[model samples]
Target chain A: MTVIEKVSEHFRVMLGQKKEEHLGTITDLMIKRYALAIGDDNPLYSDREYARKRGYEDIIAPPNMVASIVDWSVGLKEEDLHEDGTPKTGGILPSNIQGIRVMGGGEMKKFINPIVAGTDVYVTTEVIDTHVKEGKKGPIAFLVIKNTFKDAKGKIYCISERTVIAR
Target chain B: MSNTQPLQVVYSEVEIGEELPILKKNTSPLQLFRYSAITWNTHRIHFDKEYALKEGYPNILVHSHLHGAFLTQLCTDWMGDRGELKSLEVNIKRFAIPGETLTCKGTVVEKKMVDGEGLVTIDLKEINEQAEVCAPGRAVIKLPLV
Candidate 1:
């Protein structure tokens, strides 16, 4: 069987399967770095007094920060990285598809609450849907993954539905 | 420093079909590197030009989430401190390389009062230097009613 077919076979069976992860605490430095990377000078992400004036308890993360972070782990060794520089595990897809090119198609995100600095964050990821479509090259697989980010008290911070394409 | 005290957007003043001020960004290689570092994204296509060429791209490509970030910034900047982004949706239609100019633009589409709060829906898009629509998106924001 072809590699795409093999990966699809595995993903088809993974539909509705969910994985939960503890993303650790949201830090002020992390929030500041993300805003800086985006070139966003919004004080809400950095100025605690400004955030408080805006009704938040403290500095808050950018709305897309949690969803955009690819890995929350400490570190990964170079030898363990795929040729493409992606991690061997913790990706949205099965490890068997490591060599295949993966790209983001799009995302739909809902912001439920502000993620304050010092809040412990957790994520629950689930494979909501999978399909194959004919592309210019060949058959491409589309995986729709849903990620729910919440705090320790079970208050949802954000829910994102993202489509990942494998070709 | 320019937006340290952003203008507050009042819901009563917002008009339907009004175009938002454009936010233009030219992704530098350094910016892309910082973005990858901060997000812990080690995807080679975003940084390694040789690998990106081997994968059929002209140069290192921009991160998809970066497009989302630009769109989100457009919304937040327009709404200012008094407004909150409730939801945002974006579809990346094309790949963009570093050093290309990407412009984020949006138009207010609908307005409503939900639970006495002003909610505005906007149609958002990012255009490349070639005038190609790289990413199209939408956002719902809650603005303070004054």
Candidate 2:
């Protein structure tokens, strides 16, 4: 089978599969690091007092934080890692397609609500669809997955549909 | 229970053609490492230069998610204290590396009053120092009617 055909076969089986878990919670240090790493010193994400003055009890996380969820709340065990250093599991996107190149370029995001530090987040991910198309490189497979993040209080912070291209 | 936007932008005062102040940030190897660290991303292309070269990259590649962070900075910084970012859609058009300067700029495309909040839409772009478009996107922002 061609690479795309093999990958597509795998993706079709995974479609509609849903994984639900308490992925992780936002934290002050994590928020600050994320902000500084992006070189954004916006007080909204870094200073508690500034956030309080703005009527927030604590610092807020960058809006995109939910979409970048990288680990379980506790920690990522060694077994969860791939040889290349990327997390091997948890994401709805298909993994371990030998001889196929996969690239995640960007996202289609909807920030339903702002996320704050210290919020316990739960996530539900489902593989929504998959399709194949010819590209400049070769036949490209677009795997689309939807992720929804809700706080412990049941407030939805963000929902995203990300596209991962595998060729 | 609702947080106002970061900017004190009055809904009626904003015009469709208004441009948000450009948000620019410089990238380097260290900052990229920090981003990857915080996100638990261990993609070798972001940290291992030699491996990146073998993968045919000139240097370590900046995380695609980092581009999302840069775009997020542009909106939150521009909205200031009273504008809420209701939604944002960013799609990367190219890969950017460290030592490149990425700038986020957006133009107001539509404005309206919906559900008692002033909502505006923007067409956004993240461009590298070389004048190449790296990511292009759109956002929906809610502003205070007051």
Candidate 3:
């Protein structure tokens, strides 16, 4: 079977499958580094006093911070990584599809609450849908995944739906 | 230290069709590398130009999430302390490489008073140096009523 067909078939079976993970605690340094990396000067992500003045309990994470983090666990050994440098596991796709190139197509996010610095974050990822589309070069596969971030108490921080393209 | 004060946007003062202050970004290879490291993204296309070319891109590509970050900053900076972002959606239409200038802009589209809170919808977009639309997005924010 062709690669696109193979990937799509695999993703189709994963539809509705969900996996929950402990993403660890949100730290002040993580928040600050992310904001600085994006060149965002918002004091809400840095200064504790400034954030407190704005009603947040402490420094708040950027709205998209949790969703942008690619991995939360300790990384794989270098030899186990894909040729492309991506991890073989911990991703939505199976290891067999490592040869294919994957790209982020887009995302839709709903911010429910501010994620505070000391909050322990957890994520639940579910494969909502999958399909194949014809591109100028060839057929491409699209995987639609939804990620819900919440605290230990199950207080949702945000919900994000992302489209991943495989070619 | 940079100024910690945020712009106080009053709900009653926001007008439909108003334009947001533009936020411009120019990505360099070092910046992309740092972003990748911070996000724990091991994808080579974002940092290795050789690997990126093998994949048919002109150079190392910018993270799609970075585009969203720029747009988020555009909205948050404009809304400041008086408002909170409720939702944001962005679709990547094209690839953006390093050294290209990406401009993020938004236009206020609709406004409503829901449950004693003012909600505003803004259409957002990020354009590349070639004037091509790299990403188109939308954002909804809640503001305190005047």
Candidate 4:
């Protein structure tokens, strides 16, 4: 099998494995900067007073903000690579195929409850699925990773599934 | 529980071909760090230059979620407080690294009345200073009739 094929095969076996990760706290400064980075000056995300006035007890983070907190390194550590230079047990596999790039595109379903500052979060990610497709250039790998964010109390905040293509 | 806005855009006034004003956003390390601090993302690729270079990046690359947030801001701002963002999907084609100016712009691609609501489909794009398309997106919004 080719390198890409080996990587794809490895990812196939990684499905259903719980990868534990700890995401730090939510802070007002972080929320405000993220809002600013996106050019959103919404009081709900920035001003604590505005948020309290809006009935939120405190400042709230935006939807899709969980992506900013997910531990991308949960699965494969660089040291885990074998001498063959292939990831052993992660969904992020190298596309042995050439000229195809995977872009991240997906809809995020957010919880009605907002994530407030001072809350510690933990994420447990798993390989949801993988499919091979024939693309314009060549065969592509469409990989999906589902990450669940929870507070220290194990309260679910949001679930984020990122889809990427590797050609 | 709806909030009214001063800059309300009526569905009737917006045309299918109208181009939304583009807002330029510059990505900085501080912004990325702050984002990381809040999100608790400690991916070396986002801040560690050597690690990123080992991964074959020229410098620390921006977080993928940040790209989505950038697009979300553009769409929400255009929709205004009165407008409701029913659905939004962002597909990232390239990375938005630090020290790069990403221009977020959009165009109304389709408009129709669905269930007494003005549903607008917009073609969203984020381009870097080098004119490369970093993140391309699409959004479905519900606008009130003025």
Candidate number achieving the greatest lDDT relative to the actual structure:
1
Tens digit per residue, CA lDDT, model 3, B38-108 = 88988889999998888878999999999999999999998877788999999999999989999999999
Model 3: residues >4 Å from true position, as ranges? Answer: B1-4
Candidate 1 residue spans exceeding 4 A from truth: A93-99, B1-4
lDDT of 1 by residue, B1-146 (tens): 36368778888999999999999999988899999999898999999999999998999988999999999999988998778899999999999998899999999999999989899999999999999999999999999897
Best by TM-score: 3
Candidate 2 matches the true fold with a TM-score of: 0.92
lDDT tens digits, residues B56-141, model 2? Answer: 88999888888888787787777667778888888888889888888899989999888777888989999998899999998888
Residue pairs clashing in model 1 are none
lDDT of each: 0.91, 0.80, 0.90, 0.69
Task: Judging by TM-score, tell me the better candidate of 1 and 3.
Answer: 3
Error of 1 at B96 (Å): 1.1
Clashing pairs in 4: A102-A165
The stretch of ten residues in a row with the least summed lDDT in candidate 4 chain B is B1-10
How would you encode candidate 4's per-residue C-alpha lDDT over B24-138 as one tens digit per residue? 8777777777666555554566676776677667777776777778777777677765676665567777776788888988999999999888988889888999899987888
The best candidate by DockQ is: 1
Q: TM-score per model for chain B alone?
A: 0.96, 0.92, 0.96, 0.92
TM-score of chain B of 2: 0.92
